[model samples]
Target: MGLFSILNYLRLKVIVTFIRLIAKWQRRRLRAAQPGPNKKQISIPSRDPGRFIEGYLYTPPETPGSPANKKKPILVNWHGSGFVVPSLGLHDVYCARVARDSGINVLDVDYRKGPEAPFPAAVHDTEDVLKWVAGQGDQFDISRVVVSGFSAGGNLALVAASVLRSSFEELKLQIPMAIAIYPVVDITVEPAQKVVPKPIRPIPAFLARIFNDSYTPNPESRKDPRVSPALADPSSFPGTVVIVTCEGDTLAPESNALAERLKDGKRKVVHKFLEDVGHGFDDFCREGSKAWEQREAAYGLIVHTINEEFGHSG
Candidate 1:
């Protein structure tokens, strides 16, 4: 490995080791506080040898005499950890709530994170999970499938949708929509754009660089569409795309650019900008706060899109 790769490896080791110390306690507290999904754990074989992908599937309670009871729409969620940390357990509350409120099947994937697995691993694993879900016609209705993520997960979601569009032509699968909440769509932020005036900057320039370096060690690879979906062809995106950005977030500009690109491609794009909030407001803010309220609204839009696609009256 080269010098940058060596540095990235060292950084990954240090960060992951620190996280492992507190992860167990954190997971215990999260599990105790949040009610879990209907199915907690399901392992599926990955293309990578000796590595099995684990996911949590949440099936909403069935309503009597409801057509949706026979076939429920699928929502695949990817939790954000900035590519270095694996925090799938922390997202349990959000996933469970979405499943309960939307009355749809939610599958929260614990895909391999970076510094260990790196770029293509997470993207490939996401595609594998979608393929596995598609094969389960009896269990899930892939007709109205929605792929969503936050932060690094958001980047992965876009990559997954693009991959599914290009590679799975025989599957004839089209993700109706994709929801990316405050996503890091662009890894290559110009130096001038990095120094945003204070009060609106949520992610510091140095920290963003660290994330990009750790996840994508090679500077050239950072521009790859799989690593940065903002650079991808807009036509590769799903028909309907929902991008949620916070006004105070440094990443908002790229998210806006992505929405503009999608619009230019003639795709249906819902661009939501939450004023005064920072990055990770949706996942970190206390319930009933303005941030939480905005987050709920974003979720409502996602559910509304799903219902409209599936023609669900309820």
Candidate 2:
């Protein structure tokens, strides 16, 4: 590692250690305050044994319909933590709620994060999970798979879809749709510049730089299509893309830009702009609040898209 790389690594180590400590406390409180639904904790073998990936498969409660007749669709979700924290304790309630509301299998991924396994590691882990899901078609019904993510995870979702699209013919994998919630699609642009209509809580440039450095380390890596999906060809994306942007979020501009590019490329794209809310309003805001309402609306859009793709009428 070079001097800058070593410095970045050390900085990430310290920050991640502090964040993990806080995350531990947050997880305990969240678990107590908002208990998640029953989910099977399963591990997916990865090429890197040291950085094995796990996921929580949240299957909705059985309905009157028989399993043989109704094989539920799967939603593979990647949780957001700026590519540092694990998803194991962060998105429990959100993932369970998605499965419960949509009646689909929710696989909440716990992929390798930065400062330990950076850049292509998380992307590779996501691809591996998708391949594993494909192999479990009997269980997950991979014929209808939707990948969704929030913030940094959203970046991973788009990149993973692009990677899968490149190999879809050989892999026989088709990502019917994808949802990116306040995604960091362009690392090249300054976060402050990306803000539009001004944010209630603008992301600090220092923090954004930290996230970028920790995840990508090498500046040149930031230009990679996997790191910055905005740099990729619009046609490389999967069908029916949903880009959710919060008006008060510093990242909204890039998200909107990506959506516009998709539209320009004649790809089906839905752009949702939530006014007066900051980044992660969907995950952190209280229910019945305006932010929460918009968040719910976004989820409704996701469910609607899935239903439409499956040829199910409202």
Candidate 3:
């Protein structure tokens, strides 16, 4: 490796290690505090030999009217890790809550991350997971598949709904809706330039650089529709697009722009901006706090949007 790449790799290893440790602690605390529902650990086959996509599948409680053999729609979720840290189970609360409230099966998929897997690896993982989901017709209603994510995962959600939409046809899969919360849609812009109105907590410039470089490496690749997503063709998105942004977040503007682009009068695009909050505002926080309230509201909106799109209370 070259001098610059070597240095970048070394720094990223440190950052990723430290962040993942913290994430592990936080995940444990979250599980202890609010274990929403029981989930089954699953391993889905990946195109890569011996490499499997790991995930947790949360199935809603059986309803009286629902048939025992009936299949439920599935929501595939990817967690935000800046495309670097493998912050698995970080969205357990959100996934479990959605399954409980919406009565849909929720799959929290863990994909390969950057500095090792890089750019298209996660993207490919997204498509492959969807294919696996579609194949499980006996277990899930593939026709009603929906994709959702937070931050970096949100960008993946959009890409899965767009660039990978064609791949779904043969598998008989369809993503009717995609809920992206505080997504990073434009990586071409400098991290410092992204900060506006002063977020409650700003993403560190150095960390942002590491995330960007580790994931895409080539600055030129940052503009690829599959990478930035904001540069993608809006028609490529799902039938219903739900974008949630935090007013204090640097990513809000790009997310809003994406919502606007998806709204061609005919297509259904919903943009809900949460005021006085910042990125990752939906994460676990102290009860009764402002952030907590916002988190609840955002989760409610997500459940509501999914139900509405699926054409049922679930």
TM-score of each: 0.88, 0.90, 0.94
Compared with the true structure, model 2 gives a TM-score of: 0.90
Give candidate 2 regions above 4 Å deviation.
Answer: 26-38, 66-69, 311-314
Which candidate leads in lDDT?
3
Stretch of 10 with least lDDT, candidate 3 = 29-38
TM-score, prediction 3? 0.94
Which tens-of-lDDT digit does each residue in 152-256 have in candidate 2?
989988987775556654555578788888898999876556656676777778777777777887789988898999898877888789888888888888888
Error of 2 at 314 (Å): 12
User: Which of candidates 1 and 2 reaches a greater lDDT?
Assistant: 2
Per-residue lDDT for 1-314 in model 1, tens only? Answer: 88976886887678666765675666565452365537668887888777788888887766677775477778898988778677775566667766776778888898877667777778888888888887877877777678888888888888877645566545655587888888878787652374333345466666566566667767888788888888888878888888988777777888888888889756778888778777776655567888778877877776776676655533
What C-alpha lDDT values do all the predictions have? Answer: 0.75, 0.77, 0.86
Decide which is better by lDDT, 2 or 3.
3
